[model samples]
Target: MPMRGLTILVATGDAERLHTALGFAAATAATGARIRLHLHEGAVALLAAPLSAPNDPARHKAGLPKLGELWEEALGLGVAISLCQSGLALHDLDLEKLDPRLEAQGPVSVMTGLGDDRLVAF
Candidate 1:
């Protein structure tokens, strides 16, 4: 049987890592595999509204999609993107400013929801 789904844990603040994670999520989701991308720690910033992609110009100039575009594509492809609740608190980010598409959840909730999905961490 084919793989059931994929769970990606993104906990870094690095732009390249975030870009890659979203890229994988979008691509995997396009292949019809269920995808859940959980953002914790510094990665939570990606969900903030008016999303910033520091490497966007360079990536765009290099003929690649911008990071924000990749994120939108992932959402369009049915990737479930979530943010860690404690990560918001730890970073002092205003929850109200986050992307509404994201499901705010705790670690336990995320873990319990991962039913046999392959896990990948970045």
Candidate 2:
């Protein structure tokens, strides 16, 4: 049987949460599973092209990669990334501020469009 695709919903803005979600994507993709990362609420911040300040001291701890490095790894693994339309607006972030590779998707489409894909939340 073919490996299943995964749809990950990331709604938190915290760096640790983002790290966890992206790390999961990396590990899953390494196993040949398709990955779709949906960014909503504060999670959309992860896709910002400009690097955020290195404020999270814990990010430098052993073994864990920085948020930007995780993002690049996910992209390199060909993970399909989407940003929530309303979620972006609510966060007061202009669509252009995000990485151009990320598609803008509405809630209805995000929920219903995922077919037989496993859903994970962060």
Candidate 3:
């Protein structure tokens, strides 16, 4: 019952990093740890709706997840997907029009609020 908490800060991700982070976080839950995912920069597109990215031929042949699929999966697992204020604002993403999940994205203050020791910035 000693489950731990983990906060994953994703500043940016393309095809590769997205796949890895999703898998890594899902696997961590098996070790009895919680997860929080912070999104910023270009990474915000992963959850921009329809929850999918372009197919990687190699990964597709192996039935790996696409961008959107990976995000939906992580959400289903209860990882807190937070957005960065400055990052989104810089990108001109309207906070009011964003998905409900985007609201979880907050200022640096929220990051400081995590009590867990696990913090990964990618």
Question: Largest TM-score belongs to which candidate?
Answer: 1
lDDT of 2 at 15: 66
Give the better candidate number (1 or 3) by lDDT.
1
Query: Over the full model, what C-alpha lDDT does candidate 1 score relative to the true structure?
Result: 0.82
User: Whole-model lDDT for model 3 versus the true structure?
Assistant: 0.67
TM-score of 3: 0.77
Q: In model 3, which regions exceed 4 Å deviation?
A: 30-32, 45-55, 104-107
lDDT of 1 at 114: 91
Identify the leading candidate in terms of lDDT.
Answer: 1
Per-model lDDT: 0.82, 0.77, 0.67
lDDT of 3 by residue, 7-96 (tens): 777767465676677777777765667777777767765545455445656666899866666667777777667777766766666767
lDDT of 2: 0.77
Candidate order, TM-score descending: 1, 2, 3
lDDT of 3 at 103: 57
Of candidates 3 and 2, the better by lDDT: 2
Using TM-score as the measure, name the better of candidate 1 and candidate 2. Answer: 1
Estimated TM-score for each candidate: 0.87, 0.82, 0.77
After aligning candidate 2 to the native by TM-score, how far in Å is the CA of 57 from where it should be? 4.4
Backbone clashes, candidate 1: 0
**Residue 65 displacement in candidate 2 (angstroms):** 1.2
